[model samples]
Target chain A: MNILTINGISKNFGSIAALKNVSFFVPEGSVYGILGPNGSGKTTLLGIVTDVLRASSGAYKFYDGSKPVNEIRKDMGVLLETPNFYPYLSARQNLNIVAKIKGCDAAEITKALKKVNLIERQHSSFKTYSLGMKQRLAIASTLLGDPKIVILDEPTNGLDPEGISEIRQLIKLLAKEGKTIILASHLLDEVEKVCTHVAILKKGELLVSGDIDGTLSKKHGSTGENLTEQKEKTMMEVVSDDLEKLAGVLKTLNGILDINESEGVITVSCHTDELTAQQVNKHCFDNGIILSRLTVKNKNLESKFLELTK
Target chain B: MLHLLNIEFLKLQRNRSFLILIILFIVSVFGANYIVYEVSTNTGHIVHETSNKSFRLFEFPEVWQFVSFISSFLLIIPCFTVIMHTCSEYTYRTHRQNIIDGLSREQYITAKILYVVSLALFATILTVACAFFIGMLGNDPISFRDFRCVFYFFIQALTYIGLSFLLALLIKKAVLTIGIFFIYSFLIENILEKNLNRLNTGIENIGHFLPLSSSDHLLMFDILKTAMRLANIESYAPENAYLTASVIYIVLIGYACYYLYKKRDL
Candidate 1:
């Protein structure tokens, strides 16, 4: 059964639309990722579903029968944008508050702390913790009561590389235990590594949403910002005297999805590995042109990100 | 209800601001009363014997009003604590976090109201004890004659905290909220009430129902009223009217707080 269904959810702040007509469902047991770049309304959408915000014109439902939303929240663990805690309270103290709110046994607080590897410093006040420790404490707080559904917004924020990997593993482990996870991230590498399902949002619009492989494999060529999957394609920087003619001539060739020109050189982007420099040179030479410089190199990250939303 | 109270105290137990403010309230309650009592005795204003006493605020029966009146001003100390308590939830963003965890908005606001009520109860009990101890020190037969002043003090505490709570919710910053509250209570309301009194709009008027004017009227020093009566001056609002208006203000504040909380996006 679907765990959550959002129907035409839209939110506006005065004249600026934060989310517009967004709709998607998270299936039970799937690691759903709400993928978006900065200011893409990922947090706003999550805020609305968690009941800390009100949508301008839509509704959402959790699949846990007809319980009131706050009652439903007790069974669903959520860690929204920032890891806010009473600064004077220790990690254990903060978790105790969370445990009481979620109605978990005090015994589980120890287990949650241990899971996050924070039992060693559990007595340290939250303000004394490093950013990574604070993040781990928040993660441990969400795990209290062993909730069925966990929704996290940028859960890896402020963590070291090891901490990031550890959280990803923890998320995977939670999925294995039949608990559904919803993660919102701005990094495609993060989405590709841990998410089983993804909804790619850009500028308050949902570009696509579904099984991760299906969505990334089919839509990555056009979405343009899937940096992790960009490794599957070939990038050839071709330079010729007549940059405009080369760009036009290369556009006519097969598998050449995009071409860009910079400093009198053409950067041809092909989504297939079969397209190589030789084929491009032959095609150019036959069209009465010779290359000045030819090299296969990395695509400019900035250019690719600029081509993000459709 | 117990769980909710526990949740509030859990945060406050470690908060230095809350602890310091509470300590200040306790100290001010005892210190101010003692200093005034000693000064009155030295100045020959209060006689240990009840008879032939002039301006006997420290004597039996009158001491109840004296202590309550003194504490009405001292209550600002705990009122600051109340403002800090409510504003911290917003400052820390825990109000949103609490709702996200499982608390309905109603529960969050209800927790705050209960906290205010507890503070009022504590302030009242302390005042009553102070009154009882001071009243026992007198040689004359002591009576609980003017004890209703203690009740008025409780209502005044509630009103101060309720208004403080609402202001914190609106302002969301401790310093700014307290600043606005102080200016309104000390300067704005007193000026407005003074001007409204001069207009002579009649005995029954909206000015009588100003958010704080009724509480101020109820807790007015009994000596001040007696001196005014001796000078053939009249009270603009009757005692019962002040009591009724104060209760109405508390009820209205309760609803406005809940309504604002329910509608706002935390």
Candidate 2:
């Protein structure tokens, strides 16, 4: 089931169009990632759907599409841009305010604090928290009221490596509990690791959106195959002592679909299932061309993102 | 509305600045009233006399007027409080957080309006308490009729605090909003009223309806004039007219706040 349906959403800040008729749907129980570079309207799109921003022209509906945005928001947990809470208030007090606003029980505050592992330090004021703790507390806030849908914009924005991994694990755990998570991130590696579905946005416009593996595979010119099957088409870089002879032999090979040389390295694009890296080396050796290096490159989101975005 | 108000109160209860401001208001009101009581009952001083009757500042019937007039000056405390509370939401970006947490725009405005009303009501109750304290301390017998100024003082506080809320909504910055608020109340309105009064009585009559001065006119406490005449003169505008104007200002300012809140992007 589709949890959110955004239709023709557009937002303009005076003259600059932040989001231009952008539209997408978040499916139930999927960790949907909104991938975009800086100034790509990722935050703007999240703001519009969460009603923090007024769209210049557009409409969006949550849940069954029968409730008002505010009413539906009661079931959604959102953290946009930064962790916004009263600096003077402690984390527990801040989350208590959130729980009160959502009409949730006070016990939920305790549970959320525990979930973020801040139960011991919950009484410390928000300003006293370090950046990692602040981000963790923000993630914990989304757990209050046990919301069915969570919208997080750059949840791991300024965290250390350990903190980033912890947030990524938390997101996966939330998704495991059957919550629909919409994560907006500019980090390709984070999305690739955590998201079940992905939407790539550029300059406020959606380039493509679908299942993460499917989108990556399609962008790689796969014939509607699963990611594992798409992996059959791998490119290997081979540099031989005798480059001219190695290139001539590679071109004659059946599995070698395309061969090109730059400077001294010969890159051979071939079907991995038909021709393995060892076979490429064996073939070059049989031709009396000694090889210096041979490395296989499997296509990943990083490469696909750069290819499509570029 | 009550739920929103409850959340607002909870937030305020935890705010140190708000608690400090309320304590200051209480202390200032009582301390000022005590000083007035001391000066009025002193037998040695004879500032004014009417038919050989020395002026009694804290005497009942007039004490209510005196208390209300003196306390009204401290309306700035509540006004500043309202400004700080409303503008903190923007400064902290908690206003956006509140909406994202499930409050509709109208509910947010309603919560703020409720807050302003509560502060006004609090100020009114404090004034009444101070008046009763002074009346009991004085030798003059107290009458319920002496407490009519309490209602005017309530409306007056509402007008001032409501005006503050409107300014905060438009300005969004605490310091700038409070600056504009002080300037308008202290200087701009006075200048305009002075210039208009000089133009002609007709223009000055219209000037009495200006938001701040209109409420100030509600509780007219010219202590010297009242002492010389030995009678409680009514307000410049009829009591009902002043009350009506105050109610109108509150409603208009509130509606304007709601309109702006609904239209602006958080």
Candidate 3:
């Protein structure tokens, strides 16, 4: 069953179009990821879906049959932007408030806290909560009443690596329970790891979307029948402090996918089958330049997002 | 609606400001009544001694009037208190959470109205209890006749609180709305009345219709006289005109509050 169907939804603020005729379907029990750049209408799209902001045109249908939007919202859960709770209220009290609105028993509050692993600190005021805990509480609130569709925007944002791993595990567990998840995030690797299906958006337009493997393979220029003909190439992602100098040095090398600089991070994608990380580091040291970060991994979501967004 | 009302009361109970305002009003009510009792006693004794007659000055309508008069001054706290409570939902962004947590716009609005009404009733009960206690302190304690008059005055106090909350919803902020409510309800009405009286063409014709004026006059049991003074015609006294005007003001303002709250984003 289709959990959510957004049809030709467009939102504009003054002259700047936040979402331009965006359309997508969230199938039941899939971890769907929405990938976009910083100002690419990710938050706006989530806001409209969560009913916090109205769309300028178009309509969306959720899985509550033909009920009104307000009633349909009971089966849907959304966490938008930053976590917002009553700062003076304890985490338990905040969840109790959510329970009251959802018309569920307070038992669900405890259940939600347990789901987020915040039951130990449920008595702590939201003001005392770290950013990770606040986000966890937000996720807890969304899980209350056993909502069918969980929409999270930037779910693991502002978390340390450990917190990120914890949240990613939680999201995986929730999806395993058959809850449809729609994740909107700018962090490409996080989405790539967690989401089953992926959508790429740029400049308020849908660039592409499909199953993650299919979409990533298509971006890397793979045809459906050409799987056996694909060559095995080892990929390495290099992050350097001095992007211009590093790009100049990388330009003189072979076996480089491409060197791209965005904002400040310069990524040198080299085919590791011919030259390894040690070779790149040695060449950088010989050229009197320092390499800030170097790692070897497959060409993943970040590369795909950068390719589409750029 | 009952569930929403229950949630609203829970919020009101938890709010520090709401508790503080109620406590302050409770203290102010008894404190003001003590002053009224002391002054009335002194005046009654002087009248009895000078005239060589027992002056039941604190009996019947006089005690009711004295208590109600003192109460008018203290009613501002509850008015502003409820206003702040209503506007807090908007200014503090609690309204957004309220919506996110399964409250429809209508339910959200209903919760606020229920909260405002609850506060108004609470204020009215406190005012009445203070009046009853002040009556006990009088030289001639209030009879049932005086108690009935105080009951009417309590209704007027409840209306005043409701009107204040309605004004708050219309303005959607505590500071500016409550400031304007106080200035216009207390000072502007008086200044307008005095200006109208100076005109000599008609006396304060429109001042009584100003939100709190009719209720104030009705609570003091000068409804007919005040209406006559407002209309400025010599013998045309609209009987119970204060009742008519007060009812109309409450309904119209209540409707306006509902309308604006429904359309407002927050």
Let me know the TM-score candidate 3 reaches against the reference structure.
Answer: 0.79
How do the predictions measure up, each by TM-score?
A: 0.86, 0.87, 0.79
Residue B27 displacement in candidate 3 (angstroms): 1.4
**Which ranking of candidates, highest DockQ first?**
2, 1, 3
lDDT of each: 0.84, 0.84, 0.74
Which residue runs does candidate 2 get wrong by more than 4 Å? A217-300, B43-45, B48-51, B54-56, B200-204, B222-235
Clashes of each: 0, 0, 0
lDDT string, candidate 3, B1-266, tens digits: 78888878766656778788888888888887787567757896897799887554345545665566667678788887778877776665667667766677778777877766666677667766776666666556456664544555555666677778777777888899888888887788889865664565664445554567667766653443455658965232242676677778777766777777665434
The TM-score of candidate 2 is 0.87
For model 2, give the TM-score of chain B: 0.91
Best by DockQ: 2
Q: Lowest summed lDDT over 10 consecutive residues: which window, candidate 1 chain A? A: A298-307
Candidate maximizing TM-score: 2
Better of 1 and 2 by DockQ: 2
Clashing pairs in 2: none
lDDT of 1 by residue, B98-158 (tens): 9999888898889888888999999999999887877777765687888899999999999
TM-score of chain B of each: 0.93, 0.91, 0.82
